[model samples]
Target chain A: MMGLRLILEQVSHAYRDLSVLDGITLTAAPGEVLVLVGPSGCGKSTLLGIMGGMLAATGGTVSVTGEVAADCLNPLTYVFQDFALLPWRSVAGNIDLVLRARLPKAERQARIAEVLALTNLTEFAGAWPRQLSGGMRQRVGIARALAVRPACLLMDEPLSALDAQTRDLLLDEFAAIIARAGTTTVYVTHNLKEAVRLGHQIVVLSRRPGRIRATVRIDRALTDRTARDPDLLVIGEELWRMIRDDAAAAERERVDAPA
Target chain B: MPRLEGPVHFRAAGFAPKDRAWASAATLLGLLAMWQASASFGLIKSLFLPPPVAIATALWHLTVSGELWKHLSASLMRLFVGWTLGTVFGVGMGLAVGLWSALRSPGMAIVAALFPIPKIALVPLFIIWFGIGEGSKIATLAFGVFFPTVIATAGGVDNVARGLIRMGQSFGLSTGAIVRGIILPGALPAILSGFRVTTSIAIVLLVAAEMIGAERGIGAFVLSAGNLYDTDNLLAGIVVLSVLGLIVAWIIGRLERALLSWR
Candidate 1:
């Protein structure tokens, strides 16, 4: 199968009269990691939701692998920030949910086994979400998305819920895992450091109605570095400045608006 | 046994065995003593309320003569049949109405209107339609149980978290799979409680129906004893009914615990 490419052309989305995304255009090639960063309610997540086919655009086209309609991507999976694992299901059951449609019993078992090992979750297969720590649960979410073997993966602030150390550790693992899988990914977060660390191509958005403000390309070899690199810091600071200005402006707008 | 140490052991320890056993025994004795005192002191007339010992003696006599078994078996059969039918139809309809908007609006509106009409009020109609036999009795009991089960199950299914449904859809699950896998399990706790409520209603309706028109069963036995002023027999029959209801409820509670062990 051909690896996935996402192409969004002048895509606009609105909640009734309140427009969120306006005339936004972007693309992510096969095996590319596109990071979307903006202030809260700046339509970064709305754009991500549109890409994942969870929401439809009010205007323009979102083509996944040349499929014009979002629904055509039948197995487009997501890794949500909350790590929305069903509390009632065991770790293995959650992983199996994605593969239940296409794969037979044996193939499903095999795929689950492979992804469980990949995410280093083999020991906790039978454990419920409540029993596991937050980081471990997020790993289960990652394993669930990978188990689908999808053409593309969309993450909506997956690591934002974690503590600083856990977030950093998982970020490293996330970079390594996605690199090995080579699946096209669009990760949404407001954290500039995260955007700089994992994003091969970062798309910064203006405040609501959000539009792409800048797209920066990072060196792929940066993933090999153990420490926080100076290059990443420079890029993070630059992106932070852009995001801070927009966030302040958005806050001002919210305060000034009539209730 | 070696003495355990630390807060870990404290946490690991189950309920104190001595305290729990003693507490349970004391509770049972207290209830029995209260019943005996009430009946003996005539706070509750012995004709209306037999003491625990007198009820036990009456039970023993009835069991030895095999009379209690005959009445108990008949009542149990009616309860099982009516409850099973009511629960199955109620859950099925509830799931249908909860999942589908078209069905929910009209179907639930009708159920809500009719549910509170007093199922026993339909006894004369049921007798005319199904005749004054087991059919009429079972129908009354089943109808009584059905309404609550349907309402509860529908509410339960409706209350399932939307996040879980969205998650299931995103994974590309078919509608059937989503219902079977996510919706059903999500609603299991509420559905089980609905079943419990229906079970109680079925027992209540069964007794009412049996008392009105039936040759056998606990309620009929109670009615017959009342006419002869066989107060011991009447009180004994009521005791047996209470025990049967408790057993049924206990069994349902166990089933609920087993089924929802994952939760």
Candidate 2:
């Protein structure tokens, strides 16, 4: 079966007088991991929010699986930065919530078991969110998203809240999990290294009034080598340069604009 | 001077389980002893401040005559009916006001204005409307209990974490499921506290309402004893009321703990 795809045309959104996203357009093929990277206030999260149906775009159209507002296409799900695990629910309960409405009891239980195993969270099924570390909590977020069996997953800075060591470890686990599921994911982050490590293609957005700056395909290099591949480092450096330049220009614009 | 320490006493001197129990028992005995001493010495007239022994003897006499049971059963019936009805209505209205801005905005204004007026102030009006019978007494107690329960429930619902709601939405739960699964459970602890507070209020109002115009109930028996200057009976009635309040409060506390064990 073909994976889901997303297409956005002339998408613009504004918050009262301040424009956040200006005429943004992009497309992601089925099974592709599109990493949206940019500086702070670059409207990356806002754009992701719009895609996830959490925010309405002021202008333009968004279509998923070749259908705009299709009822059959499940609404996009999110993996938030804060992990956002319901404090009252245990690890398995959090994952079960997404599947409860869509799956039968036996199927839901089977799905929960599969996801918990996939996320290395089988031992944590009964643990509360507070008992889990930051990395583990984010894994629960991922597990919840996976349990829904959605067409697309929109992750906004999912690992930004973790420490460097935890982030590195989870990144490896995430790549393995995503490879198995083959789900189309739009992962948003400001970290260049994360984009290079996880993205099949990187879509760099310029700072506020964000516009798509470039789309760099890195699937070939990432697939052909080990975790410490030199080609991966080269591409990461390239993406960093592009982001740093845009970040500088965005800062200048902020200083020049009237407060 | 030689050290007075035994075994160096290295463990912390803070209240432990054994120490706490001993302290509580000692304080209770001291209070009882003081009451007995005052009555024996006639420091405060025995009529107004009966000794613990005298109160106990009075209780025994009333128990043998079946007088205590009759008034107690009447008062308890009023408390049960009034508190149950009050709790059900209060929680329902509180949840409605909390979940909907349309309901909350106007409803809160009315609740805020009326919650402060002494519910007892309405007792006279209730007596005229419902007559000086069980109807008025039950109405007064119910009204007294309702305000605190509703206010507590509303505040509890309002305080539920917004992040939890968002978390439920992200799971694609419907609006009703989100409120039922997340909001209700999250607000239960606060709501339980409100119940505990209202239980005591219900007891107080029940006795007050009974005293005003009732022929039965502990409050009425105390009033009758006052007319006859049967100080022992009056003291016994007051003691019975205090015990009733303590028992009800304890039951509510147990219920709160059981319901909110997750918290």
In TM-score terms, which candidate is top?
1
Q: Which stretches of candidate 1 lie over 4 Å from their true place?
A: A66-74, A225-227, A252-259, B1-28, B37-45
lDDT of 1: 0.85
DockQ for each model: 0.45, 0.37
Clashes of each: 0, 0
Per-residue lDDT tens digits of candidate 2, residues B5-54? Answer: 55655777668645478888999999999989988988878778778898
Model 1, B205-256: lDDT tens digits are 8888988989899989999998988788888898888888788789888998
Error of 2 at B135 (Å): 2.9
Task: Classify candidate 1 by CAPRI docking class.
Answer: acceptable
lDDT of 1 by residue, A1-259 (tens): 4578999999999999999999999999877899999887889888888887778899989887732223222446889888888877899998787667677889888877888899899989999999998899999999998887777889999998999999988988998898887778899997888888888899999899998898999866535754388888888899988889889988899889999
Candidate 1 chain B, which ten residues in sequence have the lowest lDDT sum? Answer: B8-17
Please give, for residues A68-98, the per-residue lDDT of candidate 2 as tens digits.
Answer: 2322224477889988777778999888776
Would you list the clashing residue pairs of candidate 1? none
* lDDT (Cα, 0-100) at A102 in candidate 2: 69
